[model samples]
Target: MNAKILETENVTVSFEKLSRRASELKNCFYCGASLPAISGEHIFNSSWGGSYKDKNLICCQCNFSFSNSTDKAFIIYVQAVMNSWVFKGQRHQEVPKIVLENEYFLDQGAKLKLKQPLIEDEILPDESIKSRLTFNSKSEAKRWIEGDGMATWLGRLPLAEEQEKLKKIIIETQLDRTDAKPQPISYQLNLREQYRSTAHTILKCLGFFLPEWVQGDLTKPIREFARYDKGDWRTFAIETKELFPVAEEATRILGLGVHHNSVEVYWNSSTKIVVGVLTILNRLKRSVVIAQDYSGLDSILYVVEGTHGSKKPPISVFTEFAQKQFSLPLLSVQYFSSPNNIYQYFHDELQVLMGIYYPIDAMTARLIQKIEKNNKKNLKLDQVSLEEYLNLFLSFFLDLAKVASTSVDMTKARSKLIEYGFANLAHQHVGKLYTDPDVESLMTLAFERTVKDFHAEVLNAG
Candidate 1:
């Protein structure tokens, strides 16, 4: 079965409807203050390529404060991810260069100074280096170099007399090989600040998405967090988990488009709280769940898995009378392909709840079978293959629907699939083989037919 493509028009309509509802409110949703003036607020920071905005939600003062503080933090966090392979594929923004390290290294038997910045290819894992470098600014780098430190076993600086000899050797070495391409230097990443900033940004965005009537309930704590008024901001529990090996390996071969960063927020009726989760490339996951009384001063923070996993703690929600008044679905753990497929379940559920159609396991399985049969290959579909195929099929559908674009080279796309372990399938037989106008037409027809058939089957079964 074909996955439904989320059109840009549909998204615009949804936001417009929400904005209209928000405009009718008398007070700012965030500050609970009488709105002297209201401004459009992007739920996701505008700096990060997000265009969706809600006019009439935030007061002018709150909007300015958030844009400078919370939004700035969010931009820093996204900038770090911009250097990552996964996020780079999905976003088209000018990425700022990040200083990775400052260190003394050996070049031609002489100690040389090097300051490493993040390079695109460094996202892959390597075990050759033992220690990482950290320098926040130019002054920091200068201070470390000026300070008297013991030389390591790698090498020590030359004495005053030896310096002249070493300088000659370094010049001779450079003169000999001027044609070699420079290799990217590797360094360890310290993302503590970026992570903190991202977490705060996610919480603030969640506030904007909550129903306007319920938003006032969140005003106090959110404002405090945004303003950094509370010193114990770390009280909010946050954790990051590595993606499964297969998914990770596939990402390296295919680059970041295999998965993208996403934010999901849901009202937990049982707990009488709101939960928001931010998943980075579906690899690193972080969540914040907050509960506040009517006064908002008496709020409690709980550490819960924003997504599902066998190792992750079960999500908690309290079933109280007032909480049940909302018609929203109570956040529940719905197992998808496997226990490891945790956070994606809730993400997909949010899409469904928002009237967006996503491909189910059955649909994905059927698509895989069709592809295998068409290619006359007896390929075995594993968890990783399933994910890879699902992404590819979804992207193909979106491209057909004119909602998004895909790489034009069918051969390259097919090679990525094979590299990710779909070995048995014939590349020529997959998805019309060539990306010609006629091929696109055939794909569109095939996709529409499959989706129609799947809907019919579901209706008949019901």
Candidate 2:
């Protein structure tokens, strides 16, 4: 089944056209203010390489407010991950100061007091002592490097009393990283606020695609909920209990294909639920999903489906009737990309997995039974050749490994596969896939095969 690949040129063209249309929108979608003056609002923050912006959709005041409040929180939440990735081809200028035993480890243990801009030669390959040689006072310099390699200080501590005072100030200002040994650095995150920020971003993006009619009525409510109103927006931005395996696979695929953040919106008409997903920096961090109840808002759903020539892809939409029965809408939007075949494969696999484990409600049991019956009809085992079965099995395991890696430490990902029940499938045919002797070898093989298969799928689909 040959599929039309969305080329980079095509994506850029489509996105630019969309941006132009969005810019023509007259009112601030969040505040309903007249856009007499507007500012370019990036769907994702520019710090993370998001360049797409709409020039006229948002009022300057709304844009500034979001930037200062919710957007600031979002940036803080992902700053650590962004720094680790060195996003936008630049290293972070300022990071959380790391202090060890009252001594600062500036720039990842560089031990340099930066007084001026870094020149080309300062970015050295080897670890060498590079001093800026400027100080506010001799006493400040003495206190800063009391025990370091460059602490010679011309053989004397001239301002002993002042240096002691500076040392005491360091003790008060610095965070002690020395005592927290053998443990990973932890950041205190306000989960509720982060989720709220996620909700606001999702709604803000939705404002772009939604029709003016739907936007006219819903924008005010969405704006209030996303901005000022403290009503339970948590329902829209609930976190998954377990990490999504498909998110890991999609992140990998997207990283290789698109160099920008991707947004996907999904709506279920029966349930009146709209789900928005935002993937940042190609999934170096977790993907955020926001689901909103729009059951009575069929017009909005219709508008989204018809807007921007948004055609449905050639795949089945995984809907859970169970949620509707329970008066709960369960819509999920995932932001990831894959080659056509791999995309479809993961889509089908995730549907089955979700139907099995993360069922929407009690009615999901019935939905699962129906899905299994339909699968039996659609997938003919007897017509499947031995080689095809092996390829499919290998792809499944590889995807599982990829997902496991994202959920936990990479070193322990293989073991986690076994603990998470992936070993059972492999054990039946390929022996213990994650056992000690074969674990390392199998893990390497799985990752290699996954990449190889992904390329093959891309080629075949194209």
Candidate 3:
């Protein structure tokens, strides 16, 4: 069967007063071509569980082209997170295949399977051949035995007499289970393409929610960077030091059985810059420079729950329900200016992305159960014991991938870890198996070592 391509749905409702004005997207937002008789363009990739779209913002040519280029890159980049979340988009066929080190596949329900089937035959001293077989599924084992075992093992086709003997051996073989090791995954992200796609997302959202600014001259820089790769992609959606605004509120909303997708367009009057932030599956957070010297809407928060069977309209803070629930914050007036500082921001983003496999609740439950067991034994769980338990917990559950390779600066990552109360404590408890050093340097060094061991290289598309 063919795998399902990610897809989204068209949305017609608008937010606040923007709903009153007619849409001005007569031409494609990216190529300026006449609108095609195709489905709307998704603001967020459907692979990231986005359901909302705008029918008039982009033509079929631009839409199909992007679906094959930068858009596809963005989807592939986040496949690990999407699969870990068990998030099925509007048309997801099955969980994506997340292979680690080219040997194991991460299956649904937090399980792992060997990609290659294993078969072993050993001749005993008594001249008897002891055979063993392993496969990811029973069907695979059955196919191999019935289709190829006769030629491979016996060196001849299994006739009526030999077939009975082979069948008897297969029926008598006992079943066993396979265990998987916790190894670091090696993966790459083309930052150039990812940022370009993120910038594209912001622009698409602007066309859908704020049609008044869709064709403004001030939007030229962003449009060129997103569509034609005209400028430095880094400058368009620069990484900031903080999480996207109102992230806490968004997390709460996501916990209620929905994957969150949102686009925040805010005008920072102090800096005179209009910034756009896109959050997908509440995992990827990107901020982009939409326009400079702006004079438009002060703030527009567009949120949609992206999942199957969701028919609710998009949410805006201007609505009474949203105003009471979400307290939107102003976008940052500035981002880190230095390259070293910028690289640290990306490292932090990688850490957040890794949270997709961090089973916090399950780990918490295990820790609690351990403590309770110790209590029943009348042995107090001391700090040392707790720390050792945590080390094991992190080692067992956190599915890590080295996303960056170039050495920039660990100073900022160190400081951020300390700021989050992870300095001395975390260094003593976590990452001991990988870095075996202090937490400050361990944070960066371990990630580099993990990737190096797997022979993975992450590079910029430029």
Candidate 4:
């Protein structure tokens, strides 16, 4: 360069290009594994008619693991709610019969069924042994006989001769009817795993909506509890004070076409927490803390409604998006007293569901549609004609009974509906129907009788 300075100017030039192909790869939130492009995790399980899914939330391996562990436990925990709602989602798995005390089963139709394959023996005056075997189905009877029916009768492993003798007795006995005394029925469910699984649902929802936020350090406790069964789940999950909607309220909020599930995430600014609320079949409700000690945009609400053929986008509201809409911060309400209180809440919810559920088959669906249409039309006109009111009440409540598992005569059901409707209307103004004690008592007795008749019909039909 010094030598060139004498002759001409030394020239130097450099050209540099920077290129970056932004990585779009997604990783599992739980296991931190590369996620398959085809894999998706359901925020609400498919068993609840949930179609919402997140592709990058969790890897297939973690999803499968949860399915086998916490997911299964959660299903067992809500067996009664699932069976009562008749929520046979895409999988359409048979609703498992709920086990009850004293060798009984609560069927999907809320019928108390005697667990079958029963053997009763009697000693006759002639000192002869008479035995009877009762089974639910031919397959059950065959399986018992082929496996160890004789062993059961002998109270131990049976000898070859003893088995032969039992077979002869079974073959010779004729089919006859016998009375069975109803035993007290109660249920007990373990809540520990269920609590963990419930918290898992909230975590999945958080991962679904706010992937980056959920992966941060704040959500680690819940993620650990949900995935590896680590940590005290109660700190993150609790049954909230939110009351599950009754059937009428459910009908108003969610359409009658299908059982609906809902997941809502909101920030409790007062508590510096992010909370996720889950409601299934509009019956079981719980709240889970997704994040703690959060300093972020405060007002946030994310809601996803899961239903049959659901396609609506999630409703997301943020402080920046709608400052005036939710200026008031959402404060935290105290959760239920203890996790154990969930048992009573579940009991009450099950009782309500069993009392109100009428399987919505094609016929019931059509009837409900008609009633809803008529009610809407009447309400638009500001007054319901007597005929319209009576018809709506009868079709909605009483007509459904006819198409149910129990066969109540249409004429009788209609008459009863009208009778109750008139009694309810006669006691008060249009808005206060069924508010009077006498009307309520009458309705209560009618429902009790209807339930009793249904039980009897189911027992006899079987």
Candidate 5:
């Protein structure tokens, strides 16, 4: 029998650590044999009624094929992952759960389908939480192109080895990684296709877990999944099928080749274009960076057009901010050369930024020097004394400043600032509506005073 493709919708999962006292807790919950992570048993069994809720943990070697012949519990388990569930109490405290689903087609060559849902919504800020999804195929041809047939990837964790490997594959695929290009990914797809014959083998698997902060809101929620890609920083795109909306997004990520952890791919409904980021963090060991971006849509810095010169932010301005505010130290708040300098900055001093994020390190100091150099070029001013450079840099060039290449109405600017995380520091200040535009002067003063205050806060926080 060929494995069928199955979709898991807004599946909710969690994990718990079992004490590793072999002599104390080695018995399987089902039969009391030695435990290895857990004993394997079908999530659903007809004899136990139709629900995954009644799963009985059995030892891995002891699960003697409780075939579909007698259990309906696995059937219920499959359905729950796709549908939102409302549970009470410390839900994660319950035993780790698994959602079992498989395409049971009789034809050996028949293709099976599987999909994992994500989220999206209109009117919310760009970085707001929205559901998303993915549709994968298990047939040879499609699997060759798509990578992995009825085989699936787990995003969240606390699973046994095999499940962890799948999770790592997904993470590697999603981040901006070294093998971010198409060739590596295509090669991997070919490899997974070679295993199409085993796609429906019904191996044991584990469900995913949510981050500590987010409670279980499978419907409209936020989550943290383990992810990474080799940072050799490569990126790619995919076309979207008409079935889902928000399929066209401008975001970019790294593709860390075949085996590294990668996150689920993104779909954009707006333009029918999808972009995925990948990176090979360590080419030496061939490791990848996963869960690299948490600011959501911050992956794409979208500044309203024509706002920068007007003292408002240009789209390019926001991209830099996205990189700074969300990217980890190695990736964010760095002084990458001149042209790139324009990508990220805050309205406050780097020292202030250092405070919010922690203290400034030597790398950041070099970055500050880089930004000052770049800013000098932008102003078209002649070479000045080091003191002048220091004053200008100290006054306006914030390590995490909101750089505007244009001007906008106070309301819109404030909204954009807050949405982009500047809310952590800066506030919107309204100017006299009828006065001649003195936006730069206004910005300079606001930036200076605000930066001073920010530095003080950082000192206090520290």
Candidate 6:
């Protein structure tokens, strides 16, 4: 935008206004088009009310393409954490349409709703289409840089004169420009650009899909899984981060009468695990079904400690409740930080399950099959020792491709790891193929996280 609105506050968004008129119907929300298309879109704003479709915006053809079964599930996920977001708890007014349609859009995991977009107006999408983008409205620009939010009840600081002046400049700029056409200004510390930068970097590395709601309010990262016409819940919702002392938390809350189930996706902090667990933990009796991970910690462990016994410890809620009620002590443990003795404590049925996860299994199979089928004479699987590596790489690629289709290319993949076997794959990683193949990166992450944990455990033990 042409406006050089000064930074009034420490925020990224700044205010700029144009005399008002209703929205123009020139471009399609899903696919920007000038042609004769369906008017007055049918849309789904997944980020509404935890997740509800309070709206829609689309053209006819685009709507049809998104009608398959898994579409709703994916769509629901797109609305994750979209309720209302406050960067450090500071926010600005609604973004103007002109800013969204500009060359520099702010979306990281940018997916246009087929028939409806959450924010029907123009929204910015950045380099990585699968990253979450949060752009401040003109009024919010100053706060972003200043990093100000509502004053906490206990510690309120009076603003200095200069700071107050800066805030006025920024907010005043949100008003319509006095003379000529308005424009967006850029300073090195611009919040919108900086936020876009961070969001883009995170998504690209994680191969994550940024749902529309992530930037709103749902204070957490959200991971999207592609559903291939599965007849689960026109969409089904699973909180990968949802775990507890959950299976155990169940029995305590439900009084041993209710039954429960839980699932797991380790190392993913996508959504607030606390909220997801609390919502469902009591509903299901100390029971949860989890996606067993490659990591050895994927076992289900029961707390043999009875609620009434001295050795048994109650959950956080009960402990806190009891403390509040009688000034007593009921113990609890972080779900993830469970003791290793869990194997000795729980039943055999709740064991380390190497059962391949559904989409992951389906994905692995396809990747393996494709690589096997596509092996040219010179580029055979034997030549690369890549049967396993290719399988792993393709599984990850297909996953990323589903969300960031534009950023990935399986057809163009050429890895020496795919040209040689295990030892050669190792050599290739240490040599030339480490950057693009992905298997190397995956292994690196696994190894690094493992090593870090090992060191942490040792430090704790000491």
On TM-score, the candidate that comes out on top is 3
Candidate 4 lDDT over residue span 1-462, tens digit each: 011111113322121121111122277778888865366677677766666666666778788877765665545434545554444554556765666666667565434455867778999999999887776555566567668765677678867776566566666766552211122335444455666667777666555545566678988888887788887655766544322222234445445434666555666554678777766655566667777896644444334455564744333322221232333355445655555675787666544444444232323344445555764554422125445645554454443444343444545544554454444444453443333455445544544454454445522222
- Tell me which of candidates 3 and 6 scores higher on lDDT: 3
Question: lDDT tens string, model 1, 230-322?
Answer: 434444433322222223343445343313334544444444555445554333444554433322111111112211112221122211222
Clash-forming residue pairs, model 2: none
lDDT of 6 by residue, 242-312 (tens): 33344445554553411121221122212212122212111211111112121211112121112111221
Maximum-lDDT candidate? 3
- As for TM-score, the candidate ahead, 1 or 3, is 3
TM-score of each: 0.39, 0.44, 0.61, 0.55, 0.15, 0.18
Cα lDDT tens digits, model 5, 1-462, are: 112222334321121222212223344432345544443333222121112221123455334423322122122221121111111111123212222233221111111223232223335577665433332422222332244422333333323565455455555554321100001000011211111101111111111111111122220111111111112121111111222111112221221111121111222222322222221111001111122234333222111111011221111111111222222121211112332332232112222322232112222333444545655554432223222433443433232332212222333323332333233222332222212234234433444454444444431221
Stronger candidate by TM-score (4 vs 6):
4
Give candidate 4's total backbone clashes. Answer: 0
User: lDDT tens string, model 2, 1-462?
Assistant: 122222342121111113213545677666668864545665555544444556555677767766555655545323433332223312235533332222222222112233422222243468654433434344554445575423343355436675576566544553322211111222334434555555555554555554352264534444566666456544344323222233335445433222344444444454454554555444322224333445532211101111111222111112123222233233434333334653464445334432222111112222334434544553422223222333443434343334323222332433443333334335543433222444334433544554444444421221
The lDDT per prediction is 0.38, 0.39, 0.56, 0.54, 0.25, 0.27
Full candidate order by TM-score, most accurate first: 3, 4, 2, 1, 6, 5
Model 1 scores a TM of: 0.39
TM-score of 5: 0.15
Using lDDT as the measure, name the better of candidate 1 and candidate 5: 1
